[model samples]
Target: MAARTRAIVPDRSAGIKPLNYNFEVKPPAFITFEGLDGCGKTTQIERLAGYLRSRGEPVMVTREPGGTGIGERIREVVLGQQPAPAAELALMCASRAQSVEEIIRPGLAAGAWVLCDRFHDATEAYQGGGRGFDREAIAALHRVLCGDLQPNLTLILDLDPRLALARARRLPAASRFEAESEVFFARVAAVYREIAAREPWRCRLIPAEGTIDEVAGRVREAVDDVD
Candidate 1:
């Protein structure tokens, strides 16, 4: 008897479909979630993604500092090793550059709602405010690396640093940033607020103290009119 032959079927249900280089749809929205370590960014981002998908929208969820293969490796270094301020900023920008070219730009080009957990604003908060780096320098770097790519909507989950830090510490593994003192987080939070104020057209400051559903409701409202 002849040996039996089998054919493998590809799993088309998972992962995004191949990019349509000639995609002609109106540009998709690129939204980013910004906040302190445990201010519910991860939770709200997923909730927003689900809500968008339920509306028959094409959504792609990604995170900064770990969105791509290269970014993930750099994320490990920046989160675990606690490099110097300048080095940390550099690593973050490097990751952002890779993510923009590898994941974000392509996803947007393909007409998908790109939901990012964090973006360049995180660097402005963490490095500029928390680490005392110059905001102008960070902005210059962002212009070079990201090149005018800005989120259509930045939902900043505002919460007390003390509470956010406590929530963060409850997680199984604490990151280098999580271990910083409350003062550091306060500075970060302040910077986030500043970003919201300075860029009211692009950033929305959402109060982050509530049940998941309640916070998610606010998140939804923030983007309801975002087109």
Candidate 2:
């Protein structure tokens, strides 16, 4: 049987009681960004991190499959060439496990807000939706690998797959995931929406068709809502 896992809540005060509160302040948050390859997740993450730092909030930025030295090598294999769905999923989980142990858990414990470009949501979308992996199995792996750690807020930049692919192509050499079929990306996007629908409070969907400044404004609103 799969072990029962803790659900990640967005609000810090969601389940706490005044009498049980031990800290003078709540711990920092773990915020994540999810989207298609070219949906501008990196841009928004940079903007939000800068804004947070400017406002005197200690923030740490990181990315999956490449957050740690070992994770980077795993990233190269996963993104450099096509692999079987199981291999892809395992590689992703390995990177995530290392990241949580090496970076994410420590960052939150030290009261620094963590802004990650991609988290397990990408696995759910790409491996689960696109590759037809079983969602229950994925959840079980996440529970074992990450324990109770999860994003406090997950902001997804939603965009038309056709446009997003076009934008992705203009970048340097495409990664294996980036080079996937448009139909596959459509599947990925659909799963992202489904996840947002399932967790409306923790996940916010932002249209990605607007200019940088315009999209940044929407991102700011979402962050403010969580903050």
Candidate 3:
């Protein structure tokens, strides 16, 4: 796969060469990473950003919910378990809108490769797919807030629900989604898989059953491969 990953340059204007390819550009690429709880999304995002920086590509390590100043406040409310599901999803959508407007769009415009930990996929998995909310409703709100700025490439860390739940429980503090029941996690995992199947062009499923470094290697391919 690494050998095959040698083909994804952005072009003459973008100045992106092949993998291990180092070139400068006026504006960098935008990629987002997503996965269920304990699927190592954060770890992989951090590793990818670090690797890009090591290669001398300007990289921005950002996250949804709390990427910007206003977003951090909304993150506390939406993921804190107090808000109703509908209300929480609203907050999340608003926060994501703000993030895209304030952090992501500008960073992409500035030629800094933006690596996001979680993007719109969380809403799909959690609120729409997990909580049984109206997909049309969420989609409409998202449209109004974000205007269809989906991630260019989304790498979903697919893992067994049981394993992910167990790992999540070991964490000292977790968000509302992480504290969901095992059955709920099973449902969410199903949704994540469904999305991956439905959107093969934008979504790539990487087995999340390995060590952190192993998972990061997969993420590196997703970003560097570009296709």
Worst 10 residues of 2 by lDDT: 16-25
TM-score of 2: 0.87
Greater lDDT among 2 and 3 belongs to 2
lDDT of 2 at 110: 92
lDDT of 1 by residue, 86-123 (tens): 89889999999999999899998899989999998899
Q: In terms of TM-score, how similar is model 1 to the real structure?
A: 0.87
Model 3 lDDT on a 0 to 1 scale: 0.74
TM-score of each: 0.87, 0.87, 0.85
> Could you give candidate 3's per-residue lDDT for residues 1-227 as a string of tens digits?
12122234333331211122222222366677877788888888888778888988788877878889998998887767589877888888888888888988898888788888888777878887789987556656777787756666678899999899888778777777777888898878887887777555567899988788888888777666653
lDDT of 1 at 137: 74
- Local accuracy by lDDT, each model: 0.83, 0.81, 0.74
lDDT at position 187, candidate 2: 95
Better of 1 and 3 by lDDT: 1
The residue pairs found clashing in candidate 1 are: none
Least accurate stretch of 10 residues (summed lDDT) in model 1? Answer: 16-25
Give me the candidate number with maximum lDDT. Answer: 1
**CA displacement after TM-score superposition, residue 108 of candidate 1 (Å):** 0.8
Task: Please give the RMSD of candidate 1 to the true structure.
Answer: 13.4
